[model samples]
Target: MTKPLPLALFGHPSMARRAWPLALIVALHIGFFLLLRDGLLNRIVPELPSTIVTAIIFPPAEPPARPVAASPAPKPPGPAVRTIIKPRPAVRRTPPVVMPPDAAPVSAAPAPSPIAELPPAAAPAPAVPPQPAARPVHRATVTSGVQYVRPPRPDYPAQSKRIGEEGRVVLRVLVNEKGEAERVEIQTSSGHARLDEAAREAVQHAQFRPHMEDGEPVTVFAIVPITFRLDQ
Candidate 1:
């Protein structure tokens, strides 16, 4: 006896129903696609008109020709030429003949006098008396005496306590005829304010001998230097 197939293994009837609708739809779609493809091909391709079919006629090829001649070969170079020359020595020429001396000299005419020797120079006019030379004027040079301090001060700030510092300062002072200081300039700094100030003060107070030029007083510039050392 043949074994009957199990109901569970057999496909459902609903699947069969779905398969029929899908098959129908696919068939219809295929027919529609074929019609659309045919219509597109007909629209895009143009119909060719009737024309005479002529054989492709290539122009007759020209007969092979002979190559043109290359320009005539350049003429062979001319033979190298040789020239012959003879050398001759140079000859020097002598100058023409000249007349001998012994010829008489020619005399020139004398010139007439203009004023008979210029009137003897007029006796040079009486010699003028010589004037005395003016006295020489001399410019005065004022000189300043050297300052001598009884006690020497230290050169360092810590050593000179009284002046608060110690250093050397050079001052240029203009002394007038009256022996007074007209202007004072610090020529060199002492590196210490106190020391420089002291030097200036001393110079102002110092007396000067008026410079005399031609026995007259004149103003002049003088340079004064002051030193501050320890032990003052």
Candidate 2:
């Protein structure tokens, strides 16, 4: 007899109906996974230019330094040249003329007679007037002859008196040729400006006899001492 064909080749009728839904579910899952993978692959970014990126991020390198040339030293100066001067020849002097021994001596010529001289005319004497005698010059030291026509005494400063400021003020007075005090300078201070100024004013107002030199009035400087005593 011939071998029978297997019955498994022909599927069961009830199992076929249940297998259709499971197969459909598997196909739908495979299609959804393929769509997701394709979308992720499309979103991937390309690589950037490395050279442009590096230039923007980092600074450029500096160039190498160049070598410098040295300066040349100056040369020393040469020795100076010597010069020789020639001496000039000496000048000769001519000798004076000399007389010969054989020549005869010459005689001198005779002088002519002098004309007769007339008597000199007499000149009349000029009349002379008697000259007045010179006046004697008398010089006297000013120590005793000086007389004051106006004697001024400084008024005691009320402030100085109240303060009991007592001292001597020496002043230098310049008396002119007119016997008037022309200027007054303070020689020594009385420790008070007011007292010193008062003394100067008094001396300026006073009149004095000018010093006599050769009987002529002359300007002189005299020291006048003023005593400022509060008690007196």
* Number of the top lDDT candidate: 2
Residue 16 displacement (Å), model 1: 99
Across residues 1-232, which tens digit of lDDT does each residue of candidate 1 receive?
A: 3243344544876665656667677778887799777897566677788899889989999999999989988899999888867777777778875656876655787887676555555566788899999856544333455332232232334445754665678888877767777777888998877678777777876667776666877667777777876655
Following a full C-alpha superposition, what root-mean-square deviation does model 2 have from the true structure? 16.4
Q: Worst lDDT window (10 residues) for model 2? A: 137-146
Off by over 4 Å in 1: 1-164
lDDT of each: 0.68, 0.76
**Candidate 2 global CA lDDT score:** 0.76
lDDT tens digits by residue: candidate 2, 6-61: 44543775565566577578777887788777885355554565765444556687
Model 2: runs farther than 4 Å from truth? 1-146
lDDT of 2 at 37: 78
Go through the candidates in order and give the C-alpha RMSD of each one to the true structure.
24.1, 16.4
Q: Could you tally the backbone clashes for each prediction?
A: 4, 0
